[model samples]
Target: MPKITSLAEPTQLHERILVIDILRGFALLGILLVNFTGAEIARTGRLDDEVRRLLDFLISSKFYTTFSFLFGLGFALQLLRARQRESRIVPVYLRRMVALYLIGLFHAILIWNGDVLLYYAAMGFLLILFRSLPQKLLLAFVILSLAFEFWTSLPSSPSMKISGLLPSRYTPEMEQQKELDRTLDYEKSREAWQNHTLSTRSGTYVEAVKARFQVWITGRDFLWSYFWATAFAMFLLGLYAGKKGIFHDLVRRQRLLRWTMWTTLPFAFSLNLISAYGPYVLGRFYQQIPDWGFSLLYVLAGPLGSLFYVSALLLLFVKSERWMRRLSFLRWVGRMPLSIYLMQSIIGTMVYYGYGLGMYSRLSYLVGLLLTLAVFALQIPLSRWWLSRFQFGPFEWLWRSLTYGKPQPVLVRRVRPAEPT
Candidate 1:
């Protein structure tokens, strides 16, 4: 029988990959930056076009893509460990996914509109379904998903034609009109929110729930399938990485890492630059043209950039003790990602929403950026402190208990009785 290492033991560093945790923590910084900016924009009105362009290029989808990749990698690693321990992994994993879905549902309905946990939970089930496939087959699915996204970006794609039944929501002409209506509605909602008169502020819990559903329903795009497809593609790549043990020994694999870094970095940067800027610099008429090129860059360059980053970090971890010491803080945050992620949403809403500080309309991008940094800084020390006393974060403990249909350990140590007093 294989020996089982307890994650509850903080000193057993060999059981966990510090680099992966560091990357996850780094991803959180980017995620919060984008999310905070989005919230600030909704609250205070839009940002300047130039600033918007910059954010689109730099901060838009990159971090979330990294996060999704890590999730897939983690899944593969978990399955491997289960096999090592001769355990039934599938049922346990599915239960965990379900628990995540429930948590996500509550977060979406009660806390935030931009919640991705539900989406992650949903996609995680698909990951399980595809986990046993051959590596080549997995790569093929990734390619197919990217192709689908590219095809959908074409203006002549049949999406609109299929949506003809829903004229008000689907038709391009109607969509344009709806955009205006949405802006006006949002302005009014913001005013209400600022005054603490929104359903979420002054009304009953049911009213707030209803409001949340309404927000989700209206915001869901027909292109949602494409989004999921893209996310699944990243998951597949992450699985491949885990299977190959790409992150196993960075120092020994310097040649491989260097090749990937040099090969991917240049194209990723150039492609993303073109994708972000081509619409404006080329012409306004170019904006009306097919965006397949942009989508292509996003699918191809985005992952390449993500991989390049991973390579860079692995190298740093292997070569620089000083950097490792500094980045070790991220390990704490990354270890309890779910707890930190949910905490961000709760704190963010309270800081910005009407029922709390009502500072949503007062935020600027600069202020939002500062706030993001501050929250992450707080979370680092907070996560370390919590882990010091507990076997897991509160939510993680609950999730594991539910997943295994039994109570899991929570506290790090047990009380000892005095003998022969």
Candidate 2:
């Protein structure tokens, strides 16, 4: 193996895919909508319920899966570049993950407990181990992982418990104790949520930080048991797509793209519909889906919906120049997603938290949705103007610099005429 000194450089503008950027920009919009209105807003009336239902069916879970897939695709691209340059990928990639993890820690601790970056950073290490796997094996792993996720999501499946891992000598007494412990855990979690809500809504910055930290700690079980697995599966899927060079020539792969888009749409729509309103709809027939069933549907819909979204966008880019131009505004936001994502959090906290506008738990779902759109609309032009003058977004520059152990050139230096010889 080569020395760690040989590392690949950052991707240049000419090498970027426009469709990927546009898709990322679109995902960011969905993420913003979900994040801003999520659990913070008050649900007061039918209007709020309807809006929440719509958002659940259309936006929730889909965008983050897309983002995770993109992260994997990006890793594949970096690996390819490293191989091309005959450079070692481990050193540079590890540094990148470390930097991302630190940033995520800052965001999660001081900013918001809902941060996903830390999870992504943790998964990045796992993804590195699979970088050298064959494409068939990679795809197989993704399918199996997703299948296992679905299996675990079924109501009939045995719920995971620490008692299950004990020796065969486990008796009825152990079962009773486990049940008692589960009840206690639930009550504790409920109390934690109350604290989180109160602090986030009206407490000082220090109080909010403590509350956020507590939330993060309590949420670890869900993060480890389900979220990370599905996210990693998406990462592998993206890596598979990248390794196959599918995005390199969308025109050549138009038929496949169309097939994927159309095939996934029915599943995405139907599953999401059931996940969102299965109780009401099925009750008419004197039947009802279990909570676990809804969870299963919601998890299954994420990747399917994300695939439909990406394929639809790629097809539009390939077939219609007009739509491409219309969506070109999103390109800027896509180009600097890190900055825009963090900015959304910062702005959202200020608008909702006690320290700023103090509107937490006050806005209705419709109002929150509208505010999300307005803020993202402003971000489009701001991102464009900022990127026009600089090589990268502020956070992106900082990330790159930290990864390389040196400051990267931020300004887009102009090429002046050659000096007279």
Candidate 3:
């Protein structure tokens, strides 16, 4: 929540915690991979089902969880810094959250329907409410939240089964009618989607926006408590990590990191493997809904995998200069996360939409993967260049400016040599 005034450049502030930036940068790349996968699944049948499965097993849910954790960590760190400066934290923080929500709304309605920013902004507000709770209480809340999520998502618990059986059995005619209705519904939904795709491909900006908003509205779940609870739980875990200084010094935490990596990763991999390939191996029932066991396994494994990834990456950053140098470009993208995130939506849509390149259904998974890497690789240099001349990423600057009710400086100052004395 600290304002980036002209007195101290925003670019310089990041120097103190380069690891967070690097982790953020790493998360961005993973995000692109999953986004591309989702885009492929939405518009076209999986180009390579194997690739999709591999991504599911390794990448799908991990990075977003990482981002959520980092968001919470950022909140805690910002609050501490605010206190140090004797600043009123809530006012600035509230403004920042509002700005984030606005930007997320713009992105979700106008650019991409897959936006997570709005959800993040909303959860961020809840995080503010609980930030002052004792650490033990926060951890307890986190566990309860995750448990709540798992409970809500249960395909059919005993209580649900009992309630479900209480409904009278449908008559033969009614059952037949229900089947017909479901068939008709599927056809209607499919037609709507086709039209939506057409609009996105060749429509004007207004048409595209309308199409996105319609799709999101049609698919929105007002009662999706499980997902919301899971997200908040991740945020709380992040708060706990920040409070514990787990990420403050990778070297000092090496043993903890190793223990996490060694202990959690194998089970994480095993659970995900089952989740990803269970249907093929076990039976079709494994693929059916209300398989609470598999769902719980998946939900539990995701955070563990995410933690393993973070610990491994931190160890690499602290131990190997070569790996650190290779991954340094991530810092550039990480620093301007808002800019880069929106940029991905804009560029990705332009590349795949009918109006731009119209490569949506045409692209194979391999091509999509290549495109993902290419776009991110291009962003690395561009972000570095932008940050070199500007104090903040464009959106970050705007958000900070709006939060403080004033314009923040963007361009770097050019120092002139002193005249000979």
Candidate 4:
């Protein structure tokens, strides 16, 4: 074990992983693109359809998987550090989660209903339960979690039939009632969507807040039902990688990464391709594919695609200095991911909300894409400049301060000259 340092100290600059930051920076771009296009006021027309399809194939689910894995890896690193320092991990980690939850709560309630930080914080607590499991047991847990997610994502017909075998008898009246319920649910969902769009685009700040709260409430079921398992699985995968030290020496792991990347590339591409365009293509030849089928495709594709992306990035960084320099800006953004992420939401809301330019649903996907790129391009230089003078981003400093129960120095203090000795 390494010698203990101050337990409260954050990871020092020299001890940081350059590749992780770069990968995070890259993931942020994808996340921004998805969020921007997804938030558009309108999503109709051939051009929009094409763009959406492209995004679905190329970006959807991939970046979040990466982020989730990174989160787990980060936790593993923290655990390792704690072990080295002979410190108990639970109290400090628990405080961090609580602080994160509070921050996410504020972001969701006041800024945007689509906030993911709150969900991440909730999952972090669950992660603590598996932290001490042996590597094999941890791997088993990840596999089982992903398997459960895939099973649940399978078409509902089989499960529905199995469920029908219970005490309740199927009847014509029951079928009629079920149909009615389905219709009512569809109408309710459509009405809610319309209300949300209108409120965000034109309503007052208070009205928007109310609408956001309602949307967040309504989304809780879906979030828990669909996302929780897959996200946790990715987190475990990251932990697995961290424990195995897969990322500690990219140079030594080059051959393994190359093999994994090449092996997974075909499946990732094929699965995502089918998920993106299969419905339209297969619909012509057979019955329409169920929504669950596409969802399953995504579940399978997400990790594979993310793995390929990470491996490719690592290889590129390790083998090519030119590429590394070009991508170095991502490190700045990665270093302060929390601040950048929240800033994205704030900027996005300001641009789309009623009190701002009110362009919520009015922009085309292409325009939104351009705007995402523009905003991120601007953020790169801004982050670089900020990091040059500060030890952490504003929000990062706050989170760290809260987690450690003390203020962390934000500015870079230059070396002081010795007085007359």
Listed per model in order, the count of residue pairs whose N, CA or C atoms clash below 3 Å is 0, 0, 3, 1
Cα displacement (Å) at residue 127, model 1: 0.9
Task: Specify the poorest-scoring 10-residue window by lDDT in model 3.
Answer: 156-165
Q: Which ten residues in a row have the lowest lDDT in candidate 2?
A: 1-10
lDDT of 2 by residue, 103-186 (tens): 998898899877889999999988999999999999899988787777767766654555554566657997788778877766
TM-score, cand. 3: 0.84
Error of 4 at 45 (Å): 3.8
User: TM-score of each candidate?
Assistant: 0.81, 0.91, 0.84, 0.88
Candidate 3: what lDDT? 0.78
lDDT of 4 by residue, 24-72 (tens): 8998988888888885547768998898889989998898888999999
Model 2, runs deviating above 4 Å: 1-8, 155-189, 223-226, 279-283, 290-292, 417-421
Task: Please provide, for model 1 over 50-110, each residue's C-alpha lDDT reduced to its tens digit, 9 standing for 90 to 100.
Answer: 5556766776677887898899998888867776667667877888899888888788878
Candidate 1 wrongly placed segments (more than 4 Å): 5-14, 42-54, 160-207, 216-223, 275-290, 414-421
Residue 182, candidate 1: Cα error in Å is 18
Cα lDDT, all candidates: 0.74, 0.86, 0.78, 0.83
Candidate 1 backbone collisions, by pair: none
Clashing pairs in 2: none
